[model samples]
Target: MSMEKISIIVSKGSLEGIYPALIMANGARAEGIEANLFFTFFGLDAVSTKRSGHVKIGAVGNPGLHLATFIGALPGVSGLMTRYMARKMDRLDIPPIPEFIEMISDTGAGLYACKAACDLFGLTKDDLVPQVKDIITVGEFYEIAEGGQIVYT
Candidate 1:
């Protein structure tokens, strides 16, 4: 039987969007499915080593900003929020984003940086996350996206 392949296209800059793609992609691999992730647009920052660590919890102009800021400002709320996100993933049987990305990479799920997007952001291949398998054009991604489920999160 052919393996089930799922391609996740991550395009947002928020933690909510970034984490879900990583979690789902990794969850697919845990079940022995072939999963791939294409990071483009603002989503590229989520995977960039220089930017990933600085990823902000949604706040200021974000719909959830108040809640996120409240949680972030509360004593121990930052840790709590972090744990809450992790727990939510656990409830869904998915792993945390960082670990999920690691597992997805380790399991051979294709991880790619969008070259055009990268250029738009003034980023070089070296600026991307180390997990990136390659820098590819949209056409290349479409080639892989063919005949497979494509998800944008």
Candidate 2:
């Protein structure tokens, strides 16, 4: 059977963490497949108006960076990596997080925030970006994501 839908769960707050889901969802939309992005836990930072623009890369403890934990943990290292990656993405014409989310939303893809996560973080509906359709529970997400492939990142 052909894949008709996708449900991507973003759980991390970093740049690396959020971009994969954005790319996947945008790709799915481009392919005419139904797509939904569910932002939960720390991932909410990617959709938060206050934090989306400021989300940083997680260099510490990230094996992909190939850096020692201590070095990655140093002040300014994460910020440096984040800026470096942002510049690279810019060179490739990739939009930043806010604009990316807007583009994804314009594609008719669904964007949602986890209600439990919002409650845990003391966030209200007004605190998130306008692209978020709603703040929903896991069960609600399941209901919306039913019959779709589930990808967690």
Candidate 3:
């Protein structure tokens, strides 16, 4: 049976937060399912050419670290976590962010930037990566994902 269309919204800029949305969109495309990814607020970083590759994992206040929240904020700790996450991705064979995004574009998955978000952030199409097909309104988003799953990340 054909999989249903899937719509994913990514509102966070953190690597750990964004990866699930990215991976799911890629997974849906690989399975021949229609997928749409919408970026809003800070999530725009994922589709912004200048920021896409630099989105980092947040180590602060992480429950798994078992450290006081303040320790996570130590100057080098965030970077350390980012590097460690990168290594883990490397071990798991997850491609770097840019390549993964391009793969989604090439595979026919729809990528969109929220219209109000773009305006709110004072951004334009030129600020976004080439993968974004359109800057769509909330109504347009709902229209695209009609009858499909709506996942907010």
Error of 2 at 33 (Å): 0.5
TM-score of 1: 0.76
- Ten-residue segment with the worst summed lDDT in candidate 3? 58-67
Which segments of model 1 are wrong by more than 4 Å? 1-3, 64-98
Model 2 ranges with Cα > 4 A deviation: none
Candidate 3 regions with alpha-carbon error over 4 angstroms: none
Q: lDDT scores for all predictions?
A: 0.78, 0.96, 0.91
Best by lDDT: 2
Candidate 1 per-residue lDDT over residues 1-153, each given as its tens digit: 665888999998767779878878877888888888999998887778777755544543445535654555666655555566666768987654556666679988999989999988898878877788888999999898787789999
| TM match of model 3 to true structure | 0.95
Candidate maximizing TM-score: 2
Question: Residue 94 in candidate 2 has what lDDT?
Answer: 88
Per-residue lDDT of candidate 2, residues 1-153 (tens digit): 889999999999999999999999999999999999999999999999999999999999999889999999999999999999999999998899999999999999999999999999999989999999999999999999999899999
Which of the two candidates, 1 or 3, achieves a greater TM-score against the reference? 3
